[model samples]
Target chain A: MKILVTCKRVLDPYVKARVKADGTGVNLDNVKMAMNPFDEIAIEEAIRMREAGKADEIVAVSIGAAKTEETLRTALAMGADRAVHVVTEDDIEPLGVAKVLKSLVESEQPGLVIMGKQAIDGDSNQAGQMLAALLGWAQGTNVSNVELDGDTANITREIDGGLERLALKMPCVLTSDLRLNEPRYASLPNIMKAKKKPMDKKPIDELGVDTAPRQTLVSVSEPPPRAAGVKVASVDELVDKLKNEAQVI
Target chain B: MSILIIAEHDNAEIKGATLNTLTAAAKMGDSVDILIAGSGCSGAAEAAAALPGVRSVKLADSAEYANQLAENVAPLLVQLAGDYSHLVAPATTNGKNLMPRVAALLDVMAISDISDVVDADTFERPIYAGNVLSVIKSNDATKVITVRTTKFAAAEAAGGSASIDSIDGSGDTGLATFEGQDLTQSDRPELTSAKVVVSGGRGMQNGDNFAMLDELAGKLNAAVGASRAAVDAGFVPNDYQVGQTGKVVAPDLYIAIGISGAIQHLAGMKDSKTIVAINNDEEAPIFQVADYGLVMDLFDAVPQFTAALD
Candidate 1:
């Protein structure tokens, strides 16, 4: 069966994000971008499923501007058979992105769809569940472990208290969580071979989905700063301050 | 506007986070109803009915909802969608799993993890791991939202008693079946609800080093937590993770050892009342938010701190 994984290009988590002076959005100019950490885990899980003979072909998909192709190539180097890039310059929201993914799912007919639980940038945590609802399919969000049976996938998800396991039937959606797996780095040879992999690019309009955003961003501002306090000379001094000054202990 | 809150429960009892969500929902106006969807959750319904500001409780009892599977719960919520103008829940794992599905089925955008309710249609949410706050205005007729419970105080669990009404369930979708669960059985308080939390980070190095944190946590009667870096490094289970994508905790006293405090990790705990940082690196971001900073190796500082508490 074919497995489809959705990858997103996001500002590197290591970089300090700055809100634009105009308060429209985050400043992305000259910021290094990489595949979202969660999406990287999704791609890694898909490749592992294929290696285990649970999947026949792995198709990696991404939606973004031209720079997203680099993320798709990274997926290829990590072992995706091919890739499809939905080219768009517009800043699509989670619902819009889900609609596009739904259209792709209809056309591709992949048995399973795996993607990140949320993008590090927007942190909406909505697209995968929205796509599952649009398709009227079973979904396991924040999945940490996945075991494939004959026609069902047993997914263990990280929950508030602990882990919950569910057996989702084929043609379901699964979102990767932090504990899913340790993502493997792309070796130099694999990176070289990824250039020769097939990459198909399509305009966002071609998907035939209404990509309009329902919510308007009024402003973006820096979070209230917490004033740095003084460093204690000794542990005894820290305990004294906690007891007397801060009174928290 | 009438709001329908999806209560997070485990069949037996209601979660405190649900009460916090009620606090947020009550701010959106009056006539708030809590919906309890679980197998044999009458007790949870009773708990919901006792919450202050809740006008009523809707109970959907069915075997299909035993696990609160989104496939079944979303359809049930969509069926009951017409009565309420807003659907809200605490931004817990269950809420995050279920709300988007309900929103998608209802054809509305779900505003997630909102920290503030700006009027009825506008909301404030954090993005970029809480580095930036974005104010959003939703045009959807029916707004779907998940509240960051840490941002609001939990509504009183007992006071005004609301009537409980049983609601019919939407039949199971049969798309997914619950296998089982592996909940971390701990004597310590839950991370989200704990008054004091002791967290470790990548500096812990390995799983074995977490024992030191457990020792300190045990002494302080604190819940143990870990940064995303510690969880990613296999130093702890995912449940111990406290971050933007993990559990958002706002304990009264938070102690961080060996944590560099990435923005994501800080987002989960920055709301903490008094943060204490113990790290060898003075430049660690954890120090910025800490009320008390101790620049020392965790291996030496943790033992001394724990002993000092004794």
Candidate 2:
């Protein structure tokens, strides 16, 4: 069985994101970009599955502009057998991305589709579940653990209260959550080898999916700032303020 | 416009988050009908029908939906999607799991975890860990949305009478089977709905030290939470994690003990009404958002604060 893992090039998680002056979206000028951390976990999980003899190959896919190839290369360095880049300059929504992934799933015929639960940039946890719906496949979102048995994937998901287990049949979709696994760093030798790995680029339009935006961005702005606070010298003073000044206690 | 809210519930009772989602729906006009799909969930349906502003409750009782699998629930939602102009759910783990599937089946893009409903179509949502708030307008005929329950006040649970209608269930797809669940059974208030929240971070040292926070929580009738650093340090379970990746919480009073508020951690609790930060490091980012800051050792301050609460 082959594993198809999806990735995205997002603003590096550590960087402080600033809004554009015009409030249309985030300012991406001269900022560092990296594969989404959750997607990195997805790629790592796929590689582990192959290493455990559960999967034959790992094909990493990323959708965005030319810079996305760098993210695909990182996945290759991490252990994906090959990479596919869907090139598009347009800002696509999750539904559009899911449609495109559906097209790829039809052609790739991978036994499983794995990706991040949500992108750090949009913080919208939709694509993997949407893709599963489009393909009429079983889905396990926010998955923290996975175990393969015959033709089933036993998944442990991090839910609101605690963990819930489910057994999903093969040809399914799984989204990686934070507790799944600690991602591995690519070694220098592996980074050099990644440049030699095969990578295919396909223009987004060629996939024949309606990659159109259904939502209009009205504006973007910083959240309302909280009122300034004062420091309390002692626990007694803090208790006094909570009981009297703030009236919260 | 008619709205269909998918209620999140176990077989016995509806979750509190659904009441918050109901408030969001009520804000967008009042043709709201809640769908309760669970095995032997008439109790949940009755509870939904009693919510203030709910027009009715549609119950789909079936064994296939006992576990609330996205595969089974999404199909049932799609089957009933034609009558409603909007499909809404609370942005809990269950809502986040299933709403997108319903949206995809309807071929409409969804707005997830909206903090503000500007109008029927426009909403304000946080991106970049709440650093940037984006306002959006959807053009879809049937809008799909997941409400950030913490941002909305929960509707009154009683005082309204609405009709209950039994709906047919879409048979299971045989794609997934329920195995088991390990739920944290706690006697304390739930973190999301608690009036007060007291959270710890790595500076707490270890899991054993969390007992101090628990004691403080018990004093104030609060819920205990932990920053991602604390959970990553194995000081607490993942469910105790409070962050952008974990749980979003907005309570009346939020106390942070020994927490150096990272951006992601702040995202979860910054919406709180009154924040109190107790840390030896005066420069901890948690203090920036805190309404009250105390620069002291948590080991010394926690017990004193707990004692002073009375």
Candidate 3:
């Protein structure tokens, strides 16, 4: 009953990312990097699953450059038993990432895989579902609750209007959404122990997955800024502005 | 290019987001067909065919599609992939769940939540919570896309006489079973498409305080929304959330009461035509984007504001 979780190095959610002047991408040069917030929740869920005696071992996997090892270390510190880093300098798209994960899933044979619904950086929100499709496994995306019942997993997912509960067979994929759980901070002792944990690294090419780019990033630019307006002194002034000035009401 | 829009519906009527996705597909200047997949959904298929730019409607009626399960729906989409150059859906949670699987099965990459259709193969989408916009050019033979409904105008619901055809259904895939759902029952206008949106944040204090917003919204005929902090505090359900991860809304008038807007929350409503913030904290960031700011406690200003509407 081993569980596999994914972690990604991303620009910290707190910091506003600045687009490069040349319309290429965000300037990650010396920007604060941390494990994607949602992935932290995924790792935390896997740790809790093990703690509840639902599974035996937990493996944290990441795909990125060398900096991704730091993210995996953070996952290890949080409670993953080991780490796997697929080294690639290229910023792989969701399909490529899913393909690489599929390769790893074939080799690792974990019973379940938990991943962040979307990386706040790309906001693609595709890899987990794509991986499930490729593997012909059941998928629960944007899931807030997971209860494993022997070979079946009961999942509560966030949908457009409200919540939906589903019962999925084992060997499924679950993508963590907000409200899944509040992620815990790694203790100093746990961080030191993570430094000594087993971490396996492999080149992305070794996975034999086609890491080709299907989309060319044409440009990146800041969105049109909203102009600030004057402050109204009272609620009556606000209502008058809404009625006469803006004429929205 | 021929575009196949996967219609979002509940076997009763086509959702408004489907019309918005249709508008995005129509923007590509291609013939657009819609696929309506649900058990006993012929009514929806007929309605989909009535959309202004629809060329035809393909309906797959089966119990397997009742819940819109990704595994079952993706196979049906992949089965029909050969006839179209692009597969599109609105970026609702269901579409977001389904399209990637379809794209993966077709061995193509999906572009999610595109705010603009640059061309047949290019798109513009928001990244990092809409602070930055990225233009992308896809080289895939079959482009799979999910449209951000808030960004596009919805296609008109009528004026087309497209034919509706019954398509072969994709049977059950034994992978997942629908247990149940607890959708919030609301008679009010949907938050995303409402003319006015009234949202509260952590300043609202507790769940009981939302009654003030409810009364205000009732008078204004506006939808009620909550910030992530409010939802996280259990003051409201997740569906009440209005943010990047929640529902992106761009109503005509958006009133933020007691909401110290976070970047993610602002991303959802900054496109709104007229923004008003009511918070005691004059330095709240919500004021920066607001068209009119009122520095007053929500408990006082909300009731006064609601009374003024009378």
Candidate 4:
């Protein structure tokens, strides 16, 4: 059984984001980008599954602009056998991106696929499910744990309150949430070897997948800033204010 | 163009997130049609029918919709999607799971977690846990979108006497079968639904100390929450993490216990109605925006406060 891991390059989580002055978009003039955190977990899991002898080979795939190859290399340094880069300069809508991946899956026919549950950037948490749905495969999302049996894979997901355990048939898709596993950094030796690893590009056009976008963006605006609150003297004053002024009670 | 807002729900009740999606749909276009595709969920349809701004409510109740399985909802939406130019769902777990399939089935790209609509075919979404925002334009004819509900207000419960309409089930129940469901019980309103919430952080020490937050929650009738630090430290589970990474909640009252109010943590709960802080550190950032402040140890103040409530 082979595993395909999906990842993306997004803005680094530590950088503070600022809206553009003209309000056209984010001010990315100097913002640095890195591999998405959850996708890091996805890469690590696929490599672990392969090393554990649970899978035959592990392949890493990334979708984004040219610099996103940096992210695939990051995945390779973490030990994926090969890489598939679906090159698109524009940050295409996730559904289009998923369609490109569905075509990749049809070509690869991997027994299992894993991806980060949500990209830290959009926080949409939809691509993995969309990919599974397009492929007509069983799926589990926000997964913290996964166990593969003969023809089925068991997934432990982080739901709203507690965890839900699901047993999915083989050729399934899984998206990772936090606590799934701590992603390991690429060792110096592996980082050096990753340079030589096969990094193949699949121009989305060659995939024969329709990348047509459906949604139209009307306006992009910043969320209203939180108003500074009035500080109360004591709990008594708070309760009184709640009852008399706020009328929450 | 008309917008189709897909409502997310179990047979029991519609999630508050669905109402927020309606709030977003109202911003997008004049006409709105909601699809409540779940099994025997007349309750859900009734709720959708009552939404003040909606023109039509489409109910596709079926036993197979018990899971609201993506396979089923995808084809149904695809079949029903032609009439409307846009299709949308709340970016909840169910919506995230369902709409991608519909987008794929339609052979069009779908946008996820749209915070603001840029144009009819463009949007701005945050990346890196809201640390960065990206504005992009879509070239698709009829866009599919999933929205983060925290940004929108819940639709008012105005009496609108709406029409109750039905559509045939998309019934493409593929191979997956219904396994049993495990529901978690809590007395307080859900985080997304609660008007108030009190959350703990690593400063609270351990899981047992969570009781202090719970007690305060009960007093406030608020949901219980925890910081990602608390969850990462194993003091609590991931459900409690309130940051760019976890659930986003905007409640009427918010109390932070022993939390320093990291920017990431603030991103999750900052939209709350009123903020309160109970931390030992006098300079904790949580106090900076708190509506009420207790510059004392949470361990000591929590018990005293709970006692005061009792």
Candidate 5:
């Protein structure tokens, strides 16, 4: 069975992203870019399944500018067998991305698709679920644990209140959450080997999916900063301040 | 324009998050109708009908909706999409799971976790862990949205009487089956709605150390929570997590113990009326937000503070 994993290039999670002065989007110039953290987990999960003999091939797909090939290389280094790059410069929304992935799914016909629950940059958390809907397949979002049975995937999902276990038939979509796995670092030798992996680049227009933005980003602004606070000298002072000044105790 | 608010309930009663979503919907327009889709959930429909500003309650009762699965609920919303100009729900797990699928079927974009309603078309949402806010405008004729409940106060549950109308829903999708769920049965107040919240971080070391937080929470009648690091370390379940990706909580009082206050965790509780941080690291970002900061070893300070209260 073949597994399809979706990877995205995002601003490093550790870096504080600033909105552009023009209010269009976050300033990405000179910002360090890396494969999305959750997508790393998805790639790691796919590699694990492949090692366990459940998957025969793993394909990593990414949609972004030409620079996204670097992200695909990272996935290749992490153990994906091949890479597919859908090159586009537009800021595609969740629905548009899902449509593109749906096109890929129809063509690839992979037994399973794995992706991140949400990108740290957009935080939409929509693409995987929307793709599943488009494909008329089962989906497990925010999946913390996954066990592949004969023809079904038993997935443990982290929801708002607790954990839910679901059995999704084959040809399903699984979105990885933070606790899914600890992503492995690419070794120096593997990073060198990833350069030789076959990577196919395709134009987004070829997918025949509408990539227009359904919503317009009007402006971006900083949130109201919390006022500067005081450090108490002792626990007694803290309790006294809480009781007398803040009145929250 | 009329708005359709999807009610989040448990068949017995409506969750507080739904009421908050109703509050957000009422801001968009005056005529707000709530859709209660669940098996044997008339009690929840009654609760929904009583919420202030709700014009009517639409009930879709069936076994297909017993679990409120997205496959079942999204199609029903799509089918019922003709009457309303806007579809809204709380940005809970169920809403996040269901609304995008509805938006996809309706061929529209779903605006997620909107914190403010600039107008019927425009909304304000947080990005970059709430450090930055983006104002977005939807061009779609029928708008789909999920309200961030923490940003909106819950609507009053009493004083209004709305008529209940039954609506038909689609049958089972049959793509997936719910095996079971393991919900943490706790008597303490829910983390999101608690008046006071006490959260521990990775410094808690192990799951057993969370009992110290539970004890302190008991004294203050507070809810116990954990930072994402603590949750990832297996000190507690994911439900106890207070962060951007986890539960967004804005209590009256928030106490952070040994939490270094990553931006993600701060996004969840920074809106609290008062914040108290106790950590050994004086330079922790949590201290910057703490109204009362105490730099000390949590293992030593927490027990002493509890004893002092006793």
Candidate 6:
């Protein structure tokens, strides 16, 4: 069975992102960039399925600027067989990205498709579900475990306060949660081999999806700064502070 | 057009988050309706009717509602969603589970986790945790959205005039159930529904060190949480990981201890009404938006904090 995994390039989660001085967008000159943390889980899960013989081929796909090839290469280094780049220089919202993936899936026809539950940049968490909807496929999000039958996929998902299990008819979309899989590091050997792996590029223009924003972006601003307080010397002090100083209690 | 707020229930009681979504819907427009689709969930609809601002409550109860197995809830929502101009649900596993299919069925796109409603078509949401806010306006005639209840007030029990009505059941909707529920529990808050949260991270040093905040959390009647880094380092259970990869929360008071405030983790707690930080490094990112900040070593702070709380 062929497994498809999706990833995206996002500002490093650790970076204290600053909106551009001019407000055009975030200042990226010196900031770190990497594949979204959740998407890494997706890549790891697909590779694990392949290693387990549950998948015969793993195709890692990313849709973003040309710089995203680095992310696709990272996925290949981690163990995907090849990569597909859905190119877009400008940012594309979740719906447009899903539209592009849906069209690509129609042609690729992988048995299973997996993605991170949401991206760190936008945290939309909608692309996988939207793709599932557009393709008439079943979907499971926040998946902790996946069990596949001949033509059905049984996925255990994380829910509020507990877990729920559902069976989806293949082909299906599954979004990985934090506990789904631990991503493996790219070794020196794998990193070298990744450079030799096949990588293809396609554009949202070719896939026939709207790359336009549905909503206007009026502004992007950093949240306000936190307030200040000091350490209390004792539990009694803490209680006194809660009731008297902060008065939160 | 009217808005549709999906009722959350397990054939037992309505989830608090569902009413939280109602609070968000109340902000959107004049008319709000709650949709309850499950097997024998008319009672759930009756319960939902108790929320304020609901014009009516609709239920399509059947055995199918029990599972919330998307295939069933998807079609049920799509059939009912046609009349409403806007669709909103609390961004839960259930709402996140079914709303996309409804969006797919309607062949329209949806905006998820809006922190604020701008107009009928525009909204504000946090993308990189709470670090960066994105204000988006939807062009779709029919808007579908899942609300971040943390951003909206919980629906008040002040009472409303809505009535619950039982609709014809749609039976089974073709989705299959494979596994049942088995949960992992934590001594802290459930994350999404916590009124107060005290989270720690790598700066906490070790697993046992989390107790510093544990005492404080218990005293606050809040949940204990952890950043992804803390959880990944085995300082805490995965259930405590808060960020894009972990849980997203909005609590009344959030105290982040010894956490450097990665944008990912900050995204989870940025919506808290009051944010208190304990970091030795004054430059720690977690201090950026903390309502209260302490630039002191956690070692000195934790004991002092625990002593004060207990």
DockQ value for model 5 = 0.81
Task: List candidate 5 segments past 4 Å from native.
Answer: none
- Fnat by candidate, in order: 0.86, 0.93, 0.90, 0.44, 0.76, 0.56
Chain A TM-scores, per candidate, are 0.98, 0.98, 0.99, 0.91, 0.98, 0.96
Model 2: how far residue B46 lies from native, Å: 0.8
Question: lDDT tens string, model 6, A101-186?
Answer: 88878888898999998887777778887888778777888888888778888888877656777888788899998878789999
Distance (Å) between predicted and true CA of B75, model 1?
Answer: 0.7
Better of 4 and 5 by lDDT: 5
TM-score of chain B of each: 0.97, 0.98, 0.99, 0.88, 0.98, 0.88
lDDT of 3 by residue, B254-306 (tens): 99988998988987899999999999999999999999999998888998988
Residues B95-206 of candidate 5 have per-residue lDDT tens digits of 8989988998888889999999999999999887887899999999899999989899888899899999998869999888999998988889989889999999998999
Residues B67-180, candidate 6, lDDT per residue (tens digit)?
777766777777777789998888877788777777867867778888898777779877676667777777777888998877777777547768877787666746466567
The stretch of ten residues in a row with the least summed lDDT in candidate 4 chain B is: B172-181
Taking every candidate in turn, the Cα RMSD to the unseen true structure, in Å, is: 1.4, 1.0, 0.8, 3.4, 1.0, 2.9
Candidate 1: misplaced stretches above 4 Å? none
In order of appearance, the predictions have TM-scores of: 0.97, 0.98, 0.99, 0.87, 0.99, 0.90
Query: Compared with the true structure, what per-residue lDDT tens digits does model 2 show for residues B1-310?
Result: 8999999888788999998998898777679999999999999999888887888899999989998999998989988999998899999999999999999999999999999889888998999999999999999988899999998998888997999999888998999999999998777899999999999999999999999999999999999999999987889888998988889999999999989999899989999999999999988988889999999999999999988877
Candidate 2 at B170: error in angstroms? 0.8
Distance from true location, Cα of B226 in model 3, Å: 0.8
Counting clashing residue pairs in each candidate, in order, gives: 0, 0, 0, 20, 0, 16
Quote the lDDT for A246 in model 5: 87
Give me the displacement of residue A18 in model 2, in angstroms. 1.2
**Model 5 interface Cα RMSD in Å:** 1.0
Candidate 6, residue B72: Cα displacement in angstroms equals 2.2
Which wins on TM-score, candidate 3 or candidate 6?
3
Give the C-alpha miss distance for residue B57 in model 6, angstroms. Answer: 0.5
Tens digit of lDDT per residue, candidate 2, span A12-110? 998878998877789998999889999999999999999999999999999999889999999999999999999999889999999999999999999
lDDT score of residue A111 within candidate 2: 95
* lDDT for position A110 in model 6: 93
**TM-score result, candidate 6:** 0.90
lDDT of 2 at B213: 93
Superposed Cα deviation of residue B75, candidate 3 (Å): 0.6
